[model samples]
Target: MTPEQVLVAPGRRHVYWHSALTVVVLVGAACLAHRHWPVLERGAVRLAVADQGWLLVGGTAAAATWICAALAQQGAVVRRLPQGRLVAAQFAACAANHLLPAGLGAGAVNLRFLMRCGLPAGRAASALAVKGAAAVVVRAALIVVLALACPGVLRFPRLSAGILAAGAVVVVCLAVVPAWSRCRRALAAVVADFRAVHANPSRAAALWGGSLVFAVLHALVLIAVGQAVALPLSPARVALLYLAASSAAALLPTPGGLGSLDAALALALTASGAPGAAAASAVLGYRLLTVWLPLVPGLVVLTVLIRSKAL
Candidate 1:
């Protein structure tokens, strides 16, 4: 190609990428705005009767989730992590997670953080997998414990046997499609990393403990919000409902589980005998504490961390 065409080609490519990124950001913003419009329409009136003390408690729990996330991340790897930077990364990651679907934003931030902390790319990825696996196990255990304690309160929606069979078949087919050698290598890496993390008593404790605390703190936030909004359920029951709803909603691929989680939580709360309006208010309060309130600050912190090369 001529020198002039080559020069213009680079500019055109830049424009194409820039336009693509702009479109993604705008789409994400539009989705958020659409999902939150109902809450905005109701405004402060819905929260007028909420107990300030309970709301404060909810907000505190919401804030603490980030620290728990940081601890869990640190425990995922054996390296000594800078405490302040680790927590700051989590705070920033929260904002980024909302901008991308399926946890990509947060994963990208943490992956970069791990690499910067001196881990190779593969190890960093395996560490993330280990942490995620621990989280899932802890959450599932909590759900089982709660179900056993509460008896009939934990009934799940039914699916047809044929549907279940079909799902299993689909999963098996997908698993079969991946190259056996690649899958084996990936499994080996994950297992090796998992063993390494678990071999250290402190790291194992941190991993399991942080994961459990993170899940419980999130439920506490919901429970406190329920109290603030005068939902009639017991604290234990509210926590159970939150866990169930969140587990169900996690299957959906919305950014940070935005619209899906809200809808699921509201439906679960209402099914548990809460007044529809009260359930809606509780969900709104929970989102206000966890998402909308810290969004801008989180973004700003993310920017600062990026500029400083801390992430």
Candidate 2:
């Protein structure tokens, strides 16, 4: 086979697999929606009577998340990326995020985009790690601050002894596991990139600031939805609930935290004193603005990026 053909063959295979994965995810999402149709239908009915002004606010917040995400992605690396494509890639990444569990789809898209933007494979991976780490730190910090500020707003659920024991065992196993040489090298690379990012004031600000705002905007979206649905909980309380619930849902590897986040958010809202129906309405509105509304357009952007070889 010619060298060029050999090079092109792997790309073709990757595209095929990517397409197959997308199709599977779409099918799975459809099945999930079908299974939960009753709940969704109720939510939709509630939303129809919700306050339009608050819904618009939630929609605006949702739209801004993509911009913040793009800024964070750009800040992860030193080199300047094509701004337009970078934003477009983030938009596409959000859609991909919902297509797979544990953020694999979004990560894959961002990694490919970074490599296409002239980053080496290792560096691209390191950049993603840096961005993720920043996001985690920012989110955890926000949760703590909100919890403190809202005093008594968040009630921690009691864990069974078995669950506690399992968690302990998992932590111990992780601590005791010896790292492979390659894993160690990758860790070192990520640390190096993390330090490099922090050393530059502008990049550091963008990385951390963007991460913080990205999380805050998401919480705002939830809070706005709560208002739209006339939820009794205060905005601060709602934001706290959202942050805490989303953090908990992150433990479960669900596509875009779909079922997991929905359940958690509704439960949190209900637990925080909102009526069950109101909580459900809030969750539905949040999802409508953040996920369902953007899904089609985001997918279209993804397709365009792929066709243009910008991803």
Give per-residue CA lDDT, model 1, range 121-213, as digits (tens). 788888888999999999999999998887788776799999999999987886788566576687799899899988998998899999999
Error of 1 at 124 (Å): 0.7
Model 1: residue 104 alpha-carbon error in angstroms = 0.9
Deviation in Å, model 2, residue 23 alpha carbon: 16
- In the range 82-124, model 2's lDDT, one tens digit per residue, is 9999999999999998986667778888888998988877788
Error of 2 at 296 (Å): 0.8
In candidate 1 the C-alpha lDDT for residue 289 amounts to: 92
Clashing pairs in 1: none
Q: Which parts of model 2 have CA positions greater than 4 angstroms off?
A: 1-42, 156-180
How far residue 128's Cα lies from its native spot in candidate 1, in Å, is 0.7
lDDT of 2: 0.84
TM-score of candidate 2 versus the correct structure, residues matched by position:
0.83
Number of the top candidate by lDDT? 2
